[model samples]
Target: MQTGGHIAGWRHARAADNALCDAEYFQALGRTAEKGLFDGVFLADYVGYHPVKGAAVFAGLETPKLDPLVVLATIAAATRNIGLIGTASTTYSHPYDVARRFASLDHVSGGRAGWNIVTSTMENEAHNYGFEAHLAHADRYARADEFVAVARKLWDSWQAGAVVADKVSGAYTDPARISAVDHQGEHFRVAGPLTVPRTPQGHPVLVQAGASATGQQFAAANAEVIFTSHPTIFTAQAFRADMHTQLAQFSRSPESLKIMPAVTPVIGRTRSEAEDLKRELDDLIPARIAISKLEGLLGNVDLSGADPDGPLPALPAEALAGENSTRDRVLELSEREMLPIAELARRVAAGRTGHTIVGTAEDIAETLIEWENCGAADGFVISAPFLPGGLEDFVDMVVPILQERGHFRREYEGTTLRENLGLAVPPNGFDADPTSRRRPEIW
Candidate 1:
């Protein structure tokens, strides 16, 4: 997330002001993440921000969005060990294009590439793709289901060792090591092999971002890593358990999928100091921006004239009827706490849906460890509340504590991201190895 994941993060005095256009800024952040021995640096870009009814208030979120693939490639060139995970909406893209991009990225990054797959949810995304409207959630996932299937076929077309340069025999390639996918599915009809060779990690790691029931099913069948959000340890634990059960249904082991929850850490030298920092950041939020953010989240209900200090007004039927779990949770929070419009907006702006850890470095470390020990997360996807500084703090301060406690690595575990993450390279699809660890059900 460029400036930071927090919507108002860019306004913070300490946040990087030029990150939107500054390649060097991102490169620096990648290096910092690498220094912490993070499994990957996740870049969240919107093909279109998910918008709902009255979403025009957000102008359909036609904001300048980065192409994560382009940015990840830059980071790939700069950083050697950290994984490069880029967001691409299967809803708005073709399976062949996405498959080839990540495969090339994996090869370029020395097997440190990952694809964060999303079935985009936005009207603008639909328009950009030359459609009149967004596909329904079920339809989107259905398409994504077929999209990934075809992509794997393309990736698998070129078997491992497909290239054999026998100079004397004048054989530069092995015809036996390659095959055409010739796939025909409900959403896609892809023929033959990907232009790129099989990547160093077999195929770049597949990461899925969606927590809905249907989304979870897709992740179980297709994704090797999942990016999820839950506000509490219990919620996260419940989610992890549910996913484990789902994985079994696909003939996958508990270790096959890594569940990574988004976490934002607000650290300070002392507990009181941390609380103060959180307050300071919250205070920095401009009321209009906060309310606009809330409006966007809740189907863009018009809060223009609503009193920021007043309680949340009765939401329209459409807002309440939508299946957005995040919106529902926000509503529940307001009713449960009787929080005023502005307060809730600010709260939402600061953390969105992810859990926030506010404390000293030790406190942050302990919270993370507790969550891991309690089966709440396979790992965490830390969203630095602000860039460079927030990330640097975690790397410099919190990382040492984790390393000392033996919860985190002192150095990366291996050269390739697959090795460091402890994932096996999926066997080439052309020739299936029943015993060989493969991407979940890729065959």
Candidate 2:
């Protein structure tokens, strides 16, 4: 998360100075995560200027973000083992380029790269890519489905024994082991082998974050690591249950995918200390900026004249028509909880970026265990309110408790992220023996 997930995280006293575009800052973050044996560090991306202006212009929101792959590559040199996941949109990028980049990343990181696949629906992103408007949601996912298919074919183009450095014979490669994809699909057409060879992981882990019906369908068929969000435990359970059913229909084993919901943990030694920190961060968000974010989320409907403390006005029909997963969740929260404008805006501001928990390490740890054991989640994508300090707290405080309880790992299980996550390495589509790529059991 840039600085942190919260809108006001940069202003927090604990946040590092000059983190924007700082390579060392991220390298340090990577090392810290590895110290705690985290699965990976996820780096988010926003390609173009967003329509929202108030927050960026006033609240010091980190914008013009570095390319996630470039940043993650930098982190790769500084740490080992943790998966380096970066966002790459199927909408704006071609399958060949996307596959090549991640293949190279997987090679360099020793098989610890993940692709957080997104079908971007942002009009602003469309504008930058020479499109008058973003594609429809269905069209986007359809493209993504094909995009991934092509990428996989490209990855599998080179078989395991494709490379053999023969000195005397002077044959550096095995032609029999390499094949051209020659793919012609509805969304993409790519011919031949990827420029990069087969990666260390065979294929980079396919990650996704889509909660809509079409989103779920795509995720169920493809995503190896699914990033999701739910404000309540019950909703999380419902979503996971639905996903499991969908997975069964696909004939995929339950262990094939991991569903991770983003959770922001505001931690402290005592309850009061944690509550104070949460309020302190929330209080940093300016009223105008908070309302502006809500406006953007609600399809940029003009809320300038609306009362900041009153209930949200009925969303316009136009806004309703373009509703996305994030927008729908915010609306659902408001309708279900009857939260006022100010309160709702505040939650959106202060890292209700996902479900937020404020408490001592024990309380937060217990909550995590409860969600896991109750079938509410397979895992969590922990989003700290502010960087360095917030993550360090979780690693030092919460992680230990989970480990002590025998629910979390005391040490990483294996070298590769797939191994650590207990996921099998994906087989090459071209392989005659699919199980050849399976990761050996570590435990």
Candidate 3:
């Protein structure tokens, strides 16, 4: 289980314009991750602004953020080997465009790019993109199913050695080596010879961050890397087991998909010091701001000025519907733990329900290894409580501990991110001529 970090600091920034640290900041972070011999850095990107009222907790920060892929592209030029994964919404973008962009990045980075597929969950995002309301969750997944299939078709459109670039006869490509993809799906219509040739990895690795039932099925079929959310070891174990079940349904090898739950760390030289740091970060969440966020997520059930130690106000039957999964997960955990509402809210605010492993290096390593061996996760998507420095501590401290345990690699295996991660190479494009292709007789 190698580590990764998301470039996120917009919410708690003391500065007025702390959307994302500048390019120099990303480059420095990339260099640091590489120095630790970590697998890669994955960025969680979102399309459009998060919903302010119905499902998101976006306060004090500007909405409709930077394009993650573009940011990773710039970082690609600055660093050598660390993986660059960016989120691209399948609901709004076309498959062909996505296929080209990722393949281009893979080439530029020498096969070190990853794509985190998301179906935008925010209703506000839909309106901003010209939809009156968000599509039903199942409908979005249905479209995503088709979208991923089409993207894969496009990615495999050109085989390796397709581009001859021969000058003698002015023949740039071997005509027989590439052909159009005739794809007619419910959600996409693509007739293609992809604009870009084959990437060094065949395709940039496919990553999925869906935890819904429908989403899990899609990940089983398509994703080589599964980015997931879990609030506890119990939940993580259940999720991993569920994923394997789904993978069996898809007739795919369950071991092939890497499951990484989000793990946020607030580290210090001592456990007591780390706890203080965590408290400091949590204390920064203003009561009004936290209330505003909670109300939004709870569908306008205002908990403002309510006693934090008191029982939660009774929600309507549908109050929890359409809430952020991470927040919901936290609520469930709090209920399970029988925590007082005040402490629950503070903990939830710190990392949004993902496991927050705050401790010394040995302690963090032990927790991670336990999770890995106990079906809690294959790995983690480690996020920091603070900025670059928070991540720096993990690389310097936690990574070496995992390495010494013979749990993580000392070096990468292959060139492509997929190869380095031990994932399989995607197959080539249409090899046989359509005219010569014939179906086998049915038994």
Candidate 4:
């Protein structure tokens, strides 16, 4: 069972007054996750801001803050055991740069690094990247497919035993053991081996966060860890089943992938206290802000014309075909529950529409165990609704319960991220038989 800690929770109203830019805050959070024996601490990144939401949206959030990789590098120095996974966009970055950055991180962290591959969907992100608009969903994924292929080839360019630093003979590296990738893809072209040698784990574990059909297929082919959000157990189960089927088509074992859904747990010593905390946070969020947030999750659908007290307006077909999976889940829930627009917004604000659990430590533990045992998820990415406080609460309260129940590890299982996650090291391209290579299926 793997668990990852998310630091973006400080964006909540309850945490609005906190100093989100403080490096000490994140360092402490990483330590807390390490103390709990978590598999990783994931740092989410966004290149653009939500202008529609106005200045209030930027006020409490870390949206315009430090780069994720920079922060993860700092966290790497502060903690010894926890994996540091940073988000990067294949849509915006060159594959060579991405490969080199992550490879360097892996070496610096002693193989405790992971790359959360993302095809940035925000239009503002495109503007920042010198594009008039975001790439179409399919086009973005296509580029990402080629980008990953190039990166993998670069990572595998050097043989494991290539580095032989000898003092007597004055030979630093065996030239015969390294070769140029010479990869020419539709989206990327690389001429030579990566500057750095193979990392401690051969390659940093690949993590992905896309829930669309295309996203799942990409993940099944390449990702060792998948982070997603599902509002219901049934939805999660269906997603896992679909991923399993996709994996079989690629001749990959289901065990190679770990599906971790985002779960926000509001915990307390008793259920009543937890409920009160949840209510406090819910009440703090302004209606306009909540609606704006909900709008953003729904692919920036205009909710201004929506009657606050009435049911959601008929969604356009084009909106339904967009890349946001959260929008689809929200629409499904709203229809199923016959919810008013305001009610749906409120539920989403309260985290109710996003697999949130409000309960005591034991209650949260039981829910997690149930999800894991029922195959709804391999584990969870704990999205604390508030920083230090919420993270501290889980680490001190919920983690102990999970450990006592034997549902989680009590100590660090391994040094590398892949090792702790039970993932196999990728074979060097030069050493592997061509027939044994699992080539990703391009859509």
TM values, all candidates: 0.92, 0.95, 0.89, 0.92
Model 3, range 1-443, lDDT digits (tens) per residue? Answer: 11123112333342224425477767777787788766677877656554443333454423344577777887888877888898888887889888888888888999998999998766667887898987877888889988888887777777778799888989998666665767878888888877888888887888998776778888999998998878779889998998888898888887689999989877778999878766666666765455555554444465755787876666666666653455466567667877766666665555656788878878888999999999888778887765566777888899888999988888877666887788888766355334532222220
Question: Of the candidates shown, which would achieve the greatest lDDT relative to the real structure?
Answer: 2
Kindly list the per-residue Cα lDDT of model 4 for residues 1-443, writing each as its tens digit: 01112223444544534555667767887998898888999977778855566676555322345688888888899988799999999999999999999999998999999999999768889999899988998899999999999888878877787799999999987766676777777877778678888889888889999878888888988899999888888888988988999999989998999999989889878999999877777666667766776777677788888789999998877678766666777888899989898878877766635588999999999999999888999989888877767877889899988888889987777999998999999988777754333322220
Kindly report which residue stretches of model 2 are placed more than 4 angstroms away from their true locations once superposed: 53-59, 433-443
Once model 1 is optimally superposed onto the true structure by TM-score, how far is the C-alpha of residue 435 displaced, in angstroms? 18
Which of 1 and 3 is ahead in TM-score? 1
> Residue 137 in candidate 4 has what lDDT?
88
Top TM-score model? 2
TM-score of model 4 vs. true structure: 0.92
Model 4 lDDT, full chain set:
0.81
Once superposed on the true structure, which residue ranges of model 1 sit more than 4 Å away at CA?
49-64, 167-170, 335-338, 433-443
Model 3 lDDT at residue 412: 74
Q: How accurate is candidate 2 locally (lDDT)?
A: 0.85
- How does model 3 score by TM-score? 0.89
**Which digits, one per residue and each the tens of the lDDT, describe model 2 over residues 95-144?**
99999999999999999999999987568899999999889888898899
| Local accuracy of candidate 1 as per-residue lDDT tens digits, 199-282 | 788878889988778888999999999999877899899999999999999999978899999999998999999899888888
